[model samples]
Target: MSPINFTHILTQAVDELSESESYKGLFHQHTDGNPLPSAHALCNIVELARAIIFPGYFGNSTVNSRTVTYHIGVNVERLFDLLADQIWAGLCFGGDGECNACNEYQREEAAQLAANFISRLPQLRRVLATDVEAAYNGDPAAHSFGEVISCYPAIRAISNYRIAHELLLLGVPLIPRIITEMAHSETGIDIHPGAQIGSYFTIDHGTGVVIGETCIIGNNVKLYQGVTLGAKSFPLDADGKPIKGIPRHPILEDDVIVYSNATILGRITVGRGATVGGNIWVTENVPAGARVVQRR
Candidate 1:
């Protein structure tokens, strides 16, 4: 038998991969001296943000009233530094391809965006505190707020979502999606950072939950496992491509409760105090205080 030409095969593979047509519309070409977004750095940013928000529950477990201020100040400073760099990378990523001057402008813009996000951290924490409380009070199994914060996957996922959502609101592109996808990978809860979730949002046994990009969930909403708030259909363009940035997902008003495995789709509204039961598919608007369950 003849020996294989390993070097020739490698050369052929590299040539095929490097072809412009092979990677068209899928490749991100890095400009000289410009950095792309790093998943590891973004992970660190999430961790830092979580620590700052939850204090002793995450990093610096020894934090008390005496050193809480110092710990938070340090974490916020570090978070600002890391977030600024990643936001800069995201801006570069979404900028006009191969433009050097645009990259410099985005760098400054990223810093300002990062600072704006940092300013919102206090409000973010306040909203997340409501989430933690909602999870604890809604679940009988939850022993304490500490248990919910320390042991709940919902808290972890929601914390990342809140952080990512704030960054998205601040107009830092690419990085927010990366941060939320990191949460989605870790916990099976897939929440788009573009979703507008109000305070006191709780997801019980949150695996398999998907909140779509245009979803608007109001305060005190509780979702069980396998619930999906998604779009029913996409409005396409003349070219048959789905039009981007339309209000397609459902809206849940205040104090609504959706049970496990319930799928709510489209731009319909679930009125205040409505309850959607498990394993049901709802595409229309549900009236206030209405109960929707499977017709057995």
Candidate 2:
């Protein structure tokens, strides 16, 4: 084609691309003061939370016993500010177009939610400590708590899950999923923020694990790599769209251990002390204390 023809085509393409209908559902228009949630800021927020929850392991390495409280105080304050903004962004993103009353409500709610989340920090730390313990005690190759905190993929993934879960419970949206997905991308472990997990939960090998939304996991449970607790099928509505919020994932009771590559489907309960061995398919309720292994 001639250069003139090429220029004409380029101009036509620009006009076509600029049409609103062409970009519907794809483009997000920026409002004057309503900012969209940022991946960068959320990453920093997660790091800040990690530093506060597990001091000396993340963020400032120079934090000592004498300075720990000061560091935590500063991180908490910073986290609150960052979290409030992100929460507000998330609210505005999920909300209708900005109104004065609505914006004010979102701002105030964001701060309140952020404060509530901060208040839960102590319990989060305590619960995460149990997870650290679980990881250390469950892994024969793990040498120290420090190793688990510093090096284990499970710690990172689980820590993100716990943080996201707390935020989700506090009624913050979008941001929680982003936080967990960040860990999922980095660790190859996908734990939905809606999953209800209990204390002393640990994932061995920590890769290829999928804990679906609506999963209710009890305390002292262990899951190996490649294990999935997923729904067997989705129930659809009259419109043929999958119904939302139905409890479809597996529920694991206390002291249950699911080995690597095991797929436990449906809303069935794996009773307390049950063991589902590696590379198997489980579609039914497992009684308490039963050992489910793959048939040779």
Give each model a TM-score: 0.95, 0.94
Alpha-carbon shift of residue 75 in model 1 (angstroms) = 1.0
Pick out the ten consecutive residues of candidate 2 with the lowest summed lDDT.
94-103
Clashes of each: 0, 0
251-281, model 2: which lDDT tens digit per residue? 9999999999999999999999999999999
Best prediction by lDDT: 2
Candidate 1 residues lying further than 4 Å off, grouped into runs, are 95-104
- Least accurate 10 contiguous residues by lDDT in model 1: 94-103
Model 1, residue pairs in steric clash: none
Clashing pairs in 2: none
TM-score of 2: 0.94
Task: Report the lDDT tens digits of candidate 1 across residue range 113-173.
Answer: 9889989988998999999999999999999999999999999899999998888888777
